[model samples]
Target chain A: MKIPSNLAKSSLLATGIFWVIGMTDGFHINMMAFMFISYIPVFVCCTGTILLTICPFYFFGETKHFSKRQVFQRFYPYYSIVCFALCAYGIYENTNETFLIGFFVAAFFTTMQSWIWFAKESADETV
Target chain B: MKIIITIIASMLFSTLFYDQHIGLNLTVFSLVTLVALGISNPSKLRMKETLIVMGLYLLTAILVFFNHSLLSIIANCAVFFTLVGSFSEATSSVYVKWLNGIYSSIAGTFHRNFEDKSENKKPWNEDVDVLHLIKIIVIPLVVVILFVLLYKDGNPFFEEKVAAINFDFINFQWILFCLLGYYLFSNIIVPVKVQPATDSDLATENQLKPLEPLNEDNLKKEKQLGTVVLALLNTLIVLYIISDIAFLLSNTNFAASVLSNQVHNGINALIASIIFAIIIILYFFRGNLNFFDENKTLKNLSYLWIFLNAFLVLLIIVKNAQYIDAFGLTYKRIGVYVYLFMTFIGLTTTFLKVYQIKNLWFLFRKNVSVAFMLLVLCSVVDWDAFITNYNIKNADSLDVNYLIELSNNNAFILHQKKDRMVLKSNQGARIDLKYSNYVSVLEQSNWQELSYDNFKLKTDIKSYEDTK
Candidate 1:
């Protein structure tokens, strides 16, 4: 499959961001490089590093089919749904109001650009 | 009869890896691989060949059953691999297509590669029918019941009494995070408009026809709405992050004393239930709207507002929040069990979803490779410092002395030597210190550093979290 130019750029940007974050966070890039050369088994660290690298590739590759506009539009509902599930789980496990409240706020902020935010105007106009 | 036989065979095999009973465990697992292979490829065999394969599979798996040193990780990998290979082979076989629709469905996956996607609008093959039949129908009805009766009490490693379960709310946390991520991506990260692509030729030809952008006032209004929506979502993200950190800070395992001080389980359960109910209601309405594009945003935002208001029900009933026990359940046995189930569910759905996405082969290969590498690494890594830190956090909250002593002990000393520690106790106990190395023995054996287990040894290892 041909990689779209936009997707390639996105992939590059995501990878660059990941690498920066990973390096700054003290991930062992050097160790990973060395370990990759030697067929020696270092499972967890190696896998983590590999995943960090490969995940960006998939993320980029996946967006090739959709236009940027389409991609952006598809994002919010699924993202919100996952976050909602995570926060709900947290509330259940922690049983802390503060934590639950915090998750709720996170969900809210994350979903701010969503169409649901302008429901009132639409409803009013209709009325 | 075929179904019953298959179920029995499956139970016999599953027990080889996971059964808690000794007699059945040994006999069943000893040749489980051979049996499973035979079951998968009985056609290749003459009657004699089938028996031999079954016997060999059972013998080999059972040997592992007895070889206490054999890691469950390796066995699990083997099992999944076998399942994949068998399923693929069965899908390709002529018999699969000839006898019933199962083969046709399986073969269709391969045939799909040849089909024109545009022409083939009809969906092909229920990928999970077999697994579902096994998990939902066969296992629960046949295997689990028989295992419960014959084995008695069922396998401790896999079995949890459904009636006694205290619904864990934590497993839902990851799902919530996914939802939040979706919102962030669609609404905040990128905004789209449903405008038609500009007609370039028309623009050049028709000088009199001016290009129309959406009205400036409309744009401004949309921008304002987008900003407000983003703000709300950002707040939600912030809250999730903050709460996550807070929960991590008050680590239950670390602060045993504090965790022990938790309120009654009933109150905790009730609070969680109420919150969950409210969230579920919100989610129900929230499902109606979406966040992707400008046109959709206006409509979807209305739905989101209604959802958010519905969520306020929990806040109004603040009494539910007051009942939290200061120190929650210390063991995390139930919590881990619940999370494990959720993880299993996650894995299962991920598999089903990949199939549904129609990119099963690509996603399967990528995810399996990553998953295998991660699981193995997690299994084998030396986690002394991490474990030590965790222990210190959990145990030191009450008695610093215990923490100090534990830190000074050989385990700590060994951990300090390298980032990854490998140490063995004077007793035949080996320590991997990273993920964890434990064996719960019914009887404390005489202390001697001994070789790896030559025979099957049944011992209960506490949850990795509770190892300290």
Candidate 2:
């Protein structure tokens, strides 16, 4: 991804990657995504997307540019800002606390991703 | 060739899914994705890959054909990751490959697209290249479309003119769906790997290496320390088990709440302790202790501890059985049984890891594959119907409300048993409401969306009505 437009695509790619990973493994995160996507619990319907859309790719998949690290770095700022805004919006509106949960989700996933990326690097050095 | 397959797959996606619910179409689409993956990576194709692919396909096919549940969908997706990981890298453990599959799917899409885009940038007229054609057509069309839509929103004349422009043939939403499908298909057909993580999984051995202590005598002292700790822990567990068995033998009739506490809170507590027991054992055996010349005493203690944990799982199972016998089964109780079974497997695998000198990865590999297979095995059963029938036959008294809360799989069965059941308060009314809804949905559903259970329930209801 050499161009500015590609940078935007990579950022969107990061969000898509994060969202799908949440779907495959993160049940609670999947719940949150559902809250955002729902009109009277599209959760069950959201589930079939796993089989029809992503599962085949998982069993058999591909992608890269600007290094994964750079792509994530570009994405991290925008992602965190959006999550923080949502978190604040919930408090301001005095709405459901699940809105506040976005910040924690952002933090928790950041730590996990960092560990996945860097901890193995440290571990391989030891090996 | 890749582009053409992608286009076909995308259009197929939109056609199958755009206006319909997930049913037979999903199963068909899943199969198509599998075929596409095989074609794209024919070199990776092997006997084992074929078996895994077919097994997963069978699970998807059978589940959808029978009683497609959320669990089946989940099982299918999870196994998909395991399938991708193992197919691409044969050496890594199942758990590692499972995670790698996700990483590969997401990262691989971007990486492969960028890599392939540089190669496929030729003029669109030469071939029906999606990316090139999309680039040439989509950018300008989208820009103009967006501006026109905005102006139409603001101006009545522009709106009327726009409406008259005969853009009815240009279904932007369908195009977008096709594009979305293309992006997704691109990922599966050209998957990638996270090399470092896979390497780590590959390198981690099951056998414990001998720790060369800075002082040779330290290994002996460490062994002594581990032995004392294990011995003390074993004594405590033995006492706990003896008392637990004695209480079981007392034959005190437990109140529903008391029994619930024993199974839920008490057993869950034991499970937590067992987790700690394994963690402590792993910590001791983490290194040189496995290779110690005089480590037999410590190893024996560890084995005993593991045995005791397995015994605890058995005790919990017995308590759960008693609860089920008294109050009957709920999905919560079934969850407890599954959790305990998993704990038992964990203990068994920990035993193998220690006794056989296997690595953590070996434990992970064995357990993950077992879990995956178990889930796939479970996908064939209609759990709602199973629970309903078991409760109706075996339960002392029914929680009619709870029974009614289950999926329509049990609606026909429960309706049939209404005369025999003694409902408390408005329970009969509740079942009536549920039955009416179930029948209505069954009658109204498209044939493609209805599973065998749904059809069977509808048939059973109709036949019963006819007899009446």
Top candidate on DockQ is 2
For model 2, the local distance difference test gives: 0.65
Candidate 1 ranges with C-alpha deviation above 4 Å: A1-127, B1-20, B23-86, B89-228, B239-468
Give me the displacement of residue B254 in model 1, in angstroms.
9.1
What is the C-alpha lDDT profile of model 1 across B1-468, one tens digit per residue? 333434454444343323132333433333443444345445644544234323333433443333322333253333333233333332221121111122111222222222222224443443556656657874576455455444433565444453234435433333333443332222211111111211221122201221344355555465466546644754563464455346544643433333323323323433453344334323322221222234344334433433433333222222112222222112242233233333333344333332222222333334444443343333332232333454434432322223223321123223233223222332112223321222232123222211122122221122222443
Docking class of 2: incorrect
* Cα shift from native, residue B311, model 1 (Å): 24
Which regions of candidate 2 fall more than 4 Å away from where they truly are?
Answer: A1-127, B115-163, B213-215
DockQ of 2: 0.04
Q: Per-residue lDDT tens digits of candidate 2, residues A1-127?
A: 1223322332333343334433332233115434344322322322333234322322332123343333333343233334335534654564334323332333333322332232223223333
Candidate 2 structure quality by residue, lDDT tens digits, B342-416: 788888898888898776666777887777777887777878878888888888767777888887777877887
- Return the TM-score for each candidate structure: 0.24, 0.74
The total of clashing pairs for model 2 equals: 15
**Per-residue lDDT value at B157 in model 2:** 91
